[model samples]
Target: MSEKWDKESILSLSGAFQTCRILLTAAELDLFTILSDGPKSVEDIARDKSWDERGLRIVMDALAATGFLQKSAEGSYSADETMLKLMAKNGSQSILPLVLHRNRMWESWSKLTEIVKTGSNPNPLGMASRTSEEVQDFIDAMHVVGSVMANRIVESLDLAPFKRMLDVGGASGTYIMAFLRKAPHMKATLFDFPRVVEMGRNRLTQHGFIDRVEIVAGDYTKDELPSGHDLVLLSAIIHSNSRDVNRMLYGKIFRSLDPGGTVLIRDYVLDESRTNPPDGAIFAVNMLCATSAGDSYTLKEIREDLETSGFVSVNLIRNGANMDQLISAEKPR
Candidate 1:
């Protein structure tokens, strides 16, 4: 059912972007991080950063009004204690990198109208174009989000029969670590681009699970995956590819797996209509804005693609509102 909209609600909807923009702008500016040490006057902040006082004051005021920060009668703004912790750059639990990445996404999302009109991103920003800092932030963003669900998702799966596993496009080995934690005896391979492979090595080494995993560095889209695994994971990977690319990748996964081995996909598995889950519909737009040729896929599309690539017994293992949805299939024995 559609939302019951009246004039007030419609206007409210129209102004939704304003609040998000304010938050994103503040996050991008590192305003929270700046305030994390202590409250500061707008003049103090602007002078320290060589930014315009007027612009800094306005954003801080908006943040204070929105309860993200507090403004005292003395005309200084301070970040909330809890909020500051999560936005602090060096804080272990900080999600600042993810927030900053979304701040970058604002540029792409700003061109949604143009993308819709031209049926293409006017300025497609590919992964290889990212600077070292941006690449680290992107990998950190993926890890921050993946770490939350990886353990839970791994726990739900039956890992008994699977002796060896491969994590395709596994950034920093978040899911691989989780899987290994669940079943320590299983041998594993963590595959990704070379830079990301190094990050995964550090993470696994830090966690003391390095010896159990074999790290392989290669682009799944451009190279064959490492073989001899009884299970494979493609978490949040498929939505970035077009159907044709996913089909070819599925074929690679099928070959990489031992006969009757399982390949589990964790992504936004949309229904036939592709609109049942509102977030999936919205993320479809996000993919369009971010990727050169990416959009959320319906399960039917996924099943057909997998089948064409020689996967069988496709099943919707779990339905998730966000990007946590699961689809499982196998290479025939």
Candidate 2:
């Protein structure tokens, strides 16, 4: 049965995109830090940012309405607690990069009609004619998006006893470092394209997981995986290809996994019936725009695939927001 309408849903459904734009514009302007020091009048903020006072006031008012800032009757503003913790630069996972990338993404999405009609992705990776710089920018955007999910992903899974963990298609090692922090005994082999491995290595080290994590630079499609890892992980990685490719990769993973080892697969998973969970469904649209044969999979499909690959038992755990449910399957332990 359908649920009753609520004020929250009614407002969010209508104003969500506008709210996102308000937040993104603020992030782009570094408005949080500007206000972080203390309350700032609109005139002062506009002066510092070289923005129009009238426009700034309107924008700030929206932010206040969205709870990112608190506005006083005197027309001054201060950062809210949520903004300081998640929006400000000094926070644990500063969402700045992701916000900026969204700015670029909106531009590309204007061509969604073209992509749909021609069945071609307008993204840099999908655009064969895109310049080298454009490709780098696209990959960089992916990195920023990956960073947003890294911390929680690592914390959600346990890694204490595993000595070696292989991260297949590990983009920036954000997921690896998350795991490494908890499982101090774990050493990681981060496998991905050569350039991505290099870039992610620096990022992982920047987060202080470098000493134990080994970056493996290779195309996962053609390269040989290092054997003897206690655990293998794919974080937000496998949803990029078709079921045939996924099956091939799982087979490879089974062959490479040591006896009694585990394979942990994390991505946007659809529920058993293969519907609802709006985030995963929307992400499938992104996959359509970017990947040739990629789409989100159902948990049932994942479990069946794992079992076919020799995993004894499978467990699924769901995390909130960007870090959705994933499955852990054992290799006949």
By lDDT, the best candidate is 1
All models, RMSD in angstroms: 1.5, 4.8
The TM-score of candidate 2 is 0.72
Error of 1 at 72 (Å): 2.0
Query: 1-333, model 1: which lDDT tens digit per residue?
Result: 446999999999999989889988887888888887888999998898999988888888888888889999999888776887788786658999899899889888999998999997867666777888888999899988889799778878889898999999988989998998999789899999898889899999999989999999998789999999999999988888889899889999988999999999998877788786778889889889998888899899999999999999999998878788899998989
Evaluate model 2: give its lDDT: 0.75
Model 1 regions more than 4 Å off: none
Error of 2 at 223 (Å): 2.7
Report the Cα lDDT for residue 327, model 2: 81
Candidate models: Cα lDDT each: 0.88, 0.75
lDDT of 2 by residue, 57-108 (tens): 8999999987889999898999876677667766555665566667656666
